[model samples]
Target chain A: MTDPDEAADRRLDANAAAGPLAELFTVDLTVAVATCAGCGNDAPLAAHLLYADAPALVVRCPNCAGVVLRYASSGSTLRLDLTGARLLTVTLAADGSVGISERQPHRPP
Target chain B: MSFVSRGFAGRRRKTPPGRLPPGQYDVGDGFPVLSAGPTPRTALASWDFQVQGQVDGVRRWSRTQFQGLPRESVSVDLHCVTSWSKFDTRWEGVSVDTLLADVVTAAEFAVAFSDGGYTTNLPLADLTGGQAWVVDTYDGQPLEPEHGGPARLLVPHLYFWKSAKWVRGLTLTLEDEPGFWETFGYHNYGDPWREQRYAGD
Candidate 1:
């Protein structure tokens, strides 16, 4: 079996890719809430495991290891994939402070 | 437009004379090993390759049986989504066409499942026509486990993550299905030239 500590050491949090995501969106992507389409797990993007060693940024669900988002930027062009996410909710506060809701919104009857 | 930070610029080398895709830097020698999971130690004796799902029937191959299949050597450029491109990487393996020659599938997509439960999906069209291979040797050496030894998918045109490491089998599907990284947020169809690394691209 592989060493758990070593594996953890190689992985980075989704926040590490925030700079690229911030360039595309007005708010920070790490603060956004993402729902994983694979395992139905909903959490803040910052909580996801991110692998940044490649030419692209790969974000996977901490629960199921499913890729949540992949962002690649080349020059002025930026590619963002959110197919693995059922939904991403980002709230902008009037004060300009980005608000990330930890709890997933309850479905209305 | 290129955001090569001062620190990153310090590490930059002169671009080679070939046609490289945008935002890609040439990294000479040494293919980096990056994995999202533990490197599985799969013994050859216990290793088998399978082709199933959306096919007429399941096809299986033992290690020896797989190596017995027609082999081809290819030299191709590898582009990782991380912005590094390795040129003229040579590999030897059976083409996906050879592996699926006997199996008839109406499936439009496939999910490459690997030893460590890692997976990446690709369109069925991408696996044929000499586009992809199940390579086991790199630079004439048996692939090291860290580098997805035994065998791994090689789809050079797309981001390297789409070329899953430690590949074991492919599950064909009538509809598109996201693999391990795809489920997290990787693009469904990764075309590096178009920079289709993500969904919006």
Candidate 2:
């Protein structure tokens, strides 16, 4: 299986923009399992949490009946090229590093 | 019962499309609240995206210019903070990494402002993780404005909101800013694995 990040990158490379949003909105499937964290004495969490504005869904652990709260990761940001948009400068360490220390509006050259 | 049995395999089962995962992620949160409505026909020809702030110059693109730009396709799971995992969502757009490939930026953090005025801020590392893209198509179809059509940001790793709909433009900054939901009490780094839905999340 492709790592999640790598898979997403490949998708971007292969298709400019496809049906990702619809898939997100499309109600696809449900895995019957412990809904609550306390109820199930499972080794690890089987269900993942995902939400948007408010609580999307919740289920109780039948045994312990603990509430399991799930929400989505708000991954949003801006990307730019040095010539097209504003530019930021910062020192990147030896490790594969990228960071912004300062910024100024970008001007088209 | 047999219908469900046939559809379900292992721990997974089929669900109705266009709706949340039935009992899961279904809170009657209502429409036009968290998501957008369908796109207008005129929107197709008139739609354009503006890229501003922390850049060399303000940039704007008509639907055509956007289409003319380099394109990419990616498939990844959308881990909503709401607790539903939709895997293998295929997206297409200009690779944010590619767009910013040669740009010189000094902003400390980047924020995405959407059409609904919804905003999500995060560190630059997340956006350039070699995966982010300015998504224009979803599943081989043009994105309807209701779904942030014309153009929307696709950050499969984070909650769908990070993938702002009706994404008019982008602004890079040096401060860690908060957005509409973030101000009300949403997590800064909404990681599904950590269950960070709200402040202190």
TM-score of each: 0.67, 0.54
Model 1 chain B is weakest, by summed lDDT over 10 consecutive residues, at B10-19
- After TM-score superposition, what is the CA distance of residue A100 in candidate 1 from its true location, in Å? 19
Each model's lDDT: 0.82, 0.52
Each candidate: RMSD: 7.4, 21.6
lDDT of 1 by residue, A3-74 (tens): 574464377767777787888988777778799999999878888878786546778888887777887776
* Residues A29-101 of candidate 2: C-alpha lDDT, one tens digit per residue: 1221223334333311123222223332222222332333222323452111111112212334356342222
Among all candidates shown, the one with the greatest lDDT: 1
Interface RMSD values for the candidates, listed in order? 4.4, 14.5
CAPRI-wise, candidate 1 is incorrect
Docking class of 2: incorrect
Clashes of 1: 19
Q: How accurate is candidate 1 locally (lDDT)?
A: 0.82
Per-residue alpha-carbon lDDT of candidate 2 for residues B9-110, written as tens digits (9 for 90 to 100) = 444545436434322352222223333111223456776766567877666778888789888888866656556656566778887776666556787777
lDDT of 2 at A31: 21
Task: List residue ranges in candidate 1 displaced over 4 A.
Answer: A1-109, B1-18
lDDT of 1 by residue, B106-179 (tens): 99999999986787999999999999999999999998787888999999988899999899999999989887
